[model samples]
Every structure is written in structure tokens, then in C-alpha cells.
Target: MWQIAVVLFGVANAVQVDFRPYDHSAELLFNGSDFNHDHIFSRQELEQEFQKYDADGDGRVSRHEYTTYVTTSVPELHDFAHALYDDYDVSGDHHLDHHDYDMYYAKLDADSDGSVTRQEFVDYWVKLFQATEHLHGHGHSGHG
Candidate 1:
């Protein structure tokens, strides 16, 4: 029951989606700089990043843990981060397990066949990067 305020490109009206923790988690994969401007994350990178937040060593990042991650790692998103976690409790089981993570990836399944191919996954992240770049105006900022 979290509402994510998303501004659609080329649309005057804004829409709210059932914001999920995966959305914020995925968004955080971008570096917003020269280090990883393309937002291309290899499997190892994803695993390493996930491992950093999966504090309990339970192979899952719960809502409380994700909230802490967002507040500390990406404070800019703190205001709405908790809502995203709440919305992701798809099973009403109160925990975001591996199935929830897989479901998030399944969302990028363009063909809607219940799985994401390598191309689809890559393309989705690329498109996300491009859109972010566009929204931020043209180029990546460098820390010199």
C-alpha cells in the first residue's frame, strides 16, 4: 500500500504506482557518475551489492533492513523508501523473500512469459539509465 509518485515522460499528469522495495533497490544500482554512467551491473555486482544489505545473512533484505539501507545509502529517497518496502509485501507475509526479488525481475519481462531473458534484463536497465540521464539533462556528472 505504498504510492510511488512517478512522473511519466511526455505526460503532464503524474501517476502513482504500488511502489515496491525492488523499485528503489533497482534504482540505486545506478552510479550517477563516470564510475558507472551506463548503469550496467554485472551479476557479480548485483550479488555484491545485495550482500551488503542482506545483513542477517538470511539471503533476503527485509523491509526494516531495506529502510535502513535507503536512509543511510540513499538518503534522498528516505522519505518514501519505507513506503516502497511496505508495498512489496506481495504475499502479506510481512517479509520480502527471494520470490519477491524474482518477481521484481519478472516485471522487466517484456514478453510477459513469466521470465526475463538476458537481453530483456539488460535492455530494461539500459532504458532506465537513459531515462534517468534524460531527466537529469544530458550527461553524467564527474567528481573531479
Candidate 2:
């Protein structure tokens, strides 16, 4: 079900003039998160990226902060920003903290090997976007 949304989201975005395919978005995220260029996303690197979303220097990330960052950094994801935020906010507290981060990281780390590979990261995000699209009822035009 979620996978359907992720793919639909990608297709929908592909139709827009400013559309950025889910794979591209995932690639950017993976590359950007790999600060050390090690081809692997370490927990530290992930946390660093998280901090970028933690605007205002607060220890936690509010829904607004996350949505702003996503829409600003990856406009194609704007429609699914809230869904993404809610997903990360596992505790349903309207904010993302260390616990949420840990859960998210675990989810991204599909192999449970403590680090995220480019493939793992990209696949996860693409699927997530597709799922969000389905959940949000973002109709796919199949035009692009």
C-alpha cells in the first residue's frame, strides 16, 4: 500500500515542470547525508542531517520546521511533507526527538547493519514518497 503511494508520488511529480523524481530526490538526500563521502550514511551523518532540519537550534524538530525544510530543500515532496513528518514523529508528539530519530534510522537501515547504504536509503525514500502519495490521494496523471 505504501509502496503504491511512493511510486504514484514520483509519477505525479514527474508531470510538473519542477518535478524531481523520487530516485533523484533520494539520491540527493543520500549524497548530502554522506558528509564524509564514505558511501555509507553513519548514524553521526544522519544526525547531522537531522540537525539541519532542527531549525532554531532546538534539540527537537517541530512539524513546521520539518515541513519547511522539506518543501524548501525538496519542493517535489511538499505535498507529502506532513506525512513524512508524522512518520518520523513516531511518538505522535507533534515533534521529532532522539527516540524518533532512532526509530527512523532503524527503519532506513534495512539490514540492521548499523549503517545505511545508498541503495537502502534511496529505496526507502522512494517507497515512502509513493506511499504518501497514495495515502494522500494524489492522483497520478500518467503523463510523465
Candidate 3:
């Protein structure tokens, strides 16, 4: 689903991929900066995110609770997290790797801003999902 695609995009962008042909930008991204894209989130940004979700002032988010909240809230991103856990959790460690993060980062950060602002990330995926959803919803009506 769109959720899986979006998360994959984000994680991929955060991690660099080995390019065989080496297109212009892919070459740059593959070799550029840290090649790990560690600058995805600043401490300020993470704190802000925590503030946004930690509505009860509990100062913590458990894995189950956080996953539910995100999935229910977006309705589209639940599949994304699931896919991330499935594909990129290479060692079955139930966690993401820097390579995964780099790959996701590159795909989502269209503007190459070095950081994915939330709105940018959402907008990028929203358009992708909507377009794909329309294509999926299309039917020939048995008339074609």
C-alpha cells in the first residue's frame, strides 16, 4: 500500500544505495556527504515530534501505543511501518538500519533539503498515494 511505499521512500532516502549505472543525482546521493544521511533529524526536531505526540505529558511513547496512534491517525502509514519492519529490518532485529534510513531519505526528500520537513514528507506521499489509489480504483466497467 501507499504506507509501505512512503516509509520505504523515507528510509531509503536516509540511507544511500549502491548504484550500478550511477545516474546524475543518484551518483551524488550515493557518494555525497556522509552517504548515510545522518542529518535527517535534529535534536530540536525530535523534541518537537515528541511534544506533538506525547499529549498526556507522559514523556514517553511505548512501541504498541505509538504504532497504534500513528496508524490510526494516518490510516495510510500503518502499512508503511509494517513494511519497514519487514524489508529493512534485515537481521530481524526489529529495528531500522542506517542504510534503510538513507534510502528512505533520498526518495522522500525531493527538494534535497537535507532534512525532510513533515509537511514535505506528507505532501510527497499523499500525492503518490492519491494517484496510485485513483489508478487502482479505476475499472473498465465491463464496457471496454
Identify the candidate with maximal TM-score: 2
Model 1 per-residue lDDT tens digits across residues 63-142: 77877776563343444555455544446565776665555545556777754444565466555434444332233223
lDDT of each: 0.47, 0.71, 0.40
Error of 1 at 89 (Å): 3.8
> Of the candidates numbered 2 and 3, which has the greater lDDT value?
2
- Which runs of model 3 end up more than 4 angstroms from their true locations? 1-95, 131-144
Q: Which stretches of candidate 2 lie over 4 Å from their true place?
A: 1-21, 72-78, 134-144
| Sliding window of 10 residues with minimal summed lDDT for model 3 | 1-10
- For this target, which candidate reaches the highest lDDT against the unseen true structure? 2
What tens digits encode model 2's per-residue C-alpha lDDT throughout 80-118? 678778877878999888888788889999999988899
The collision pairs in model 1 are none
What is the Cα-based lDDT of residue 112 in candidate 1?
A: 75
Model 3 error, position 123 (Å): 1.6
The collision pairs in model 2 are 5-130, 5-131, 5-134, 6-129, 6-130, 6-131, 7-130
In what order do the candidates fall by lDDT, top score first? 2, 1, 3
